[model samples]
Target: MRILMGIFVLAIYGGITFYLGWNLRTWLLAIQQFRWPIAYWIGLYAISFGYFIGKLHPLLTPFSIVGSYWMFFLQYGLILCVIANLLIAFTPLTTKLVGTWVISVLIVLLIVGTYFAYSPVIRNATIEIDKPGEDMRVVVASDFHLGVLSGKGHLEKFVQLSNEKNPDLVLLPGDIVDDSPKRFINKGMGDVMQQLQATYGVYGVPGNHEYYGNEMKQFREAMEKANVQILMDETILVGERFYLTGREDLTNKNRLPLSKLKPEDNALPWFVMNHTPNDLDEPANLGVDFHVSGHTHKGQMWPNHLITERIFELDYGQRGKNDMHALVSSGFGFWGPPTRIGSRSELWVIDIQFAK
Candidate 1:
């Protein structure tokens, strides 16, 4: 079944690529006859399949990066192509005119999205927990996805922005490393992360990407060495005030449940970080005062967020039920392509006021 599904998906992807290439050929032919049909098809398909081809080996990372951008183009390009085709069919508009407009609009969208992806925004929220503690400024940044595309420069910006907030607690929900932590460790990104200034400490949990890499020991060691703690299905009391419970990414079926991972001192305000915000009721039912997560990337692109909004209850931003406040970040890094449409890279500076 899985093999069949994979084949079906590949077929659909190939069909789309072919359609897009054919339209491009038609558009170019309208302007002037092109002779390199074989080269054109080869380049089109190669760029389309760059990501998967590059994924087969680490040496082809440049191909992977180029392919990742193509994936985004494929997504929006398909939509624009369809719309342009429809306009050409229904209206008196010529293919050249419609195609010109479509390509121009697509280019603008990609440029804007790339701009938003690189520009990180700080989102703020305040929650008053009915627990005794000093006012805490917690900075939550998730989904850094530090790999070939999002390099150490992005981490430096994150550290700089996070330090400016002067957060009491720095909580990274997940996806700190992309598919593998190789580039992150090899490039010394962890050292940049260590510069994050938080009064309490910096803590994070594993995202599905971490499992994808299957290098938990290396990822954890790198993080710990940088003073960024990776909590795996465990609860810890910080400053003897609040309790932080970081659950293993849902990818791990053997991970402990929210009930089992409760802090020894449950009376303190309990904060839970589960990489994917699939199960909110579990923590809410367990009386967790705050729940933070990432993984949706808020769809990470235009109209993609619409799908994520349906899958998760609170896909992005803060929500509340009684005293429990939950926040799901859009994340600080891009996953595949460094493009963000209808969403911007964001980190939350949550101001927590504990009850007197």
Candidate 2:
């Protein structure tokens, strides 16, 4: 199975490299950057190799961080080039002109996209739930994906934003760290994590990427050192007013479901932390007061949000009926592009009232 997966990945990577190179072939030839065809081939191959590095981004560290931006440019640039060539399929205009236009536009978009990626805006939302008690302000955010590229600066900003909200409880759904939790510790994010001030404390779940590189041990250790509690299919009472149940991330098939993990004491307000928003019916059916999640990133980039829209009913916001409500965060941090074109990077400041 692993071998088959590897082959599948290789095939896709190869196809993308071939298509991008062919689409930009004329531009490559016209450029004096490479005096010889051999050098040109080397350069193209190096760029093409960026895709693989991106796939293994969690482990590649600082190099992958820089490579991620380039990969995004290459990805979009190729698509634009393909579209231009198709639009002018048989036109007499030289392909060079189309290529130049596409390249120029790609550069401009890259700058704009970078700015968008770094500047994540805070989103404020309020949802009401039954199970009477005192009002509570819960801050829920996820998909930080902090690693080589999305690093210290991003972490500092996120922590600051989360703290400034002054949420009673800070809930991290998943994908908190990218490559390795150790990276967070080594990169000073561990200290930042400790600075996240919440009366009820900060809680987290493990996302797929946390397990991607067999870094669960490191992840657990980081959480402990940072004073963040990781709840793997566990439930705990917070503030003696509500129950916070954090389920294992969707990545684990053996993970316990909401039915088993949710505290049977239905008197207290319940908040469920789930990484992926899929299977929302389960949480709703279980009578959860609020289900918080973040893996979707609301597609993160243009047209990508559309794909997520088709997949999740509550892809990027709040929705519920009666006693059950779900809040899906686009994410506090980001992945690949570090830019938010179609979607905004976000932290959800949830003002919760416990009135009957």
Candidate 3:
């Protein structure tokens, strides 16, 4: 049954891609005219091979499985070609077509460069808990994807940024690495973890990407090496003031629970950390004080932020009532293509103050 559903979903995704390609046929043709014939042919063949490899191993690569990354590059190249041809075909007086292309390329480079350079800055915010006379300050970041793209330097920057925050407790909601941490054992992430310093300690939950390759075990081991606490269907007390709970992803129900976890005392301030922001009602009903999460990445690019807003109640900021606030961070790292168009990668600095 699962296989059948997966196949059906893939079929729909493929249809969409094909439709998009068909719509850009004229643009593709025009671009092809400007491209070196051999290079164009080789690029096409490589893209086709990536698609086949992705389909054969969906669990190993979700980006390839959904054809999203490929589609982005393919469509982006086609769009550039189309725009260039339009400019040339129109023969506009100010045609600096080459200049325009150069500018566009530079803009993309600038965006990517800025995202990496400033990615280490930890963003801060404050949240007010409903309880009286008690307060907690929490630091939250998500989607580090710390493998090939992030590497050791990026991890070092992250640790440095996080340390500067001086958070009472740190929350890593998920996607700490792009691949199995074991794959990068000698890459110095362990050393980076050793440098991690938080007053209340660091807690992490698994994201869908971790489950995508069944790499949760490797991820947990990596976190442990860094002295991070992995919270899977469990709750803990911090400073005799708040209850911290972490849950497994919604899709992995067999490995964890889908329902809300109850605290031993109903009056204590409680914080719940989960990957996706779905199932708010469960926590709300349980009187969870705040829910911190970051799977949306605010679409990680332009126009897609709108899509994320529609899909999630709290897509990239604070929402819900004073009793139960749901805060979602845009994320600290990029997922694919290494670009963030409309949304900047962010970290949440939440100050939880109990009312007096």
Candidate 4:
């Protein structure tokens, strides 16, 4: 079934690539009398499919970086092409004119989207809980995707942002690294992350990407050396104030359920770090006080958020279910290309007030 699904997805991707390439070919032919079909097709496919090809090995980091950018280009370009074709068909608009408009629009989007991608914004929220404790400020960031495309610089920015907030605790819900933590480790990003300042400590859960890398031991070692704690199906008490349970990413089939992970004798408010927001009902059903997650990237690109919205009830931002408050970050890093359209790279600063 998985094989079939993969093949089906690839087929659709290939079809789209062909459609886009053909349309662009037509535009080039008419506009500039561009005639290098061989070179054009090779360049187009390389950019379009580079991400997947690069993912086959860690050495092809350059290809992955270039290919990732194609994701947004493909999405927006395809949309523009479809619209342009429709206008040309229905109206008296010529292909050359529509082509010019579409290309110009894409250039503008590229510039604006790149700005949003690189500029990480802070989003603040306040939550009141019935548990007794001091009001705490928690800085939560996720999906650092700290690989070749997103390196030490982005991590430094995240550290600076979180430290500036003077958080009581720093929590990384997941995807702290890209598919692999190789670049993060080699570039000494862990040393940079060690600079994150918080009253309690820094902690993180594994995102599916971590599992994809299949290098948990190394990833854990790097994080620990940098003073960031990795929580598998583990629970810890923060200065006797609250309980934090880090659930293994859904990628782990054998990970414990919330019922087993949560301490039965606990009275303090419990905060759960879940990488993906799919199993939200479990946390709510288990009476978790707060649940935080990432991995959605809120569709990182435009209109993609629409798809993510359909997949998860609370795909982005804060929502409440029963007594549990859930917050999902769009993530602080990009997945493929460092380009975000509808979503901006964000760090969430949550102010939690407890009952006296």
Measured by lDDT, the strongest candidate is 1
Whole-model lDDT for model 1 versus the true structure?
Answer: 0.90
Arranged by TM-score, best first: 1, 4, 2, 3
**RMSD for each of the candidates:** 1.1, 2.4, 4.8, 1.6
1 or 2: which has the higher TM-score?
1
Which is the leading candidate under TM-score? 1
Q: Weakest 10 consecutive residues, lDDT, candidate 3?
A: 19-28
TM-score of each: 0.98, 0.92, 0.79, 0.96
Misplaced by over 4 Å in model 2 are 1-5, 31-34, 51-63, 90-92
Q: All models: lDDT? A: 0.90, 0.80, 0.70, 0.90
Better of 2 and 3 by lDDT: 2
Please write out the lDDT profile of model 4 over residues 71-120, one tens digit for every residue: 87788989999999999999998989999999999999999888998899
Pairs of residues clashing in candidate 2 = 58-179, 117-338, 117-339
**How much is 112 displaced in model 4, in angstroms?**
1.0
TM-score of 2: 0.92
Candidate 3: residue pairs that collide: 125-349, 131-355, 132-355, 133-355, 134-354, 136-352
lDDT of predicted model 2: 0.80
Q: Name the runs in model 3 displaced over 4 angstroms.
A: 1-39, 47-72, 78-121, 132-134, 255-260
Total clashing pairs in model 4: 0
Residues 272-296, candidate 1: write the lDDT tens digits: 9999999888888879999999999
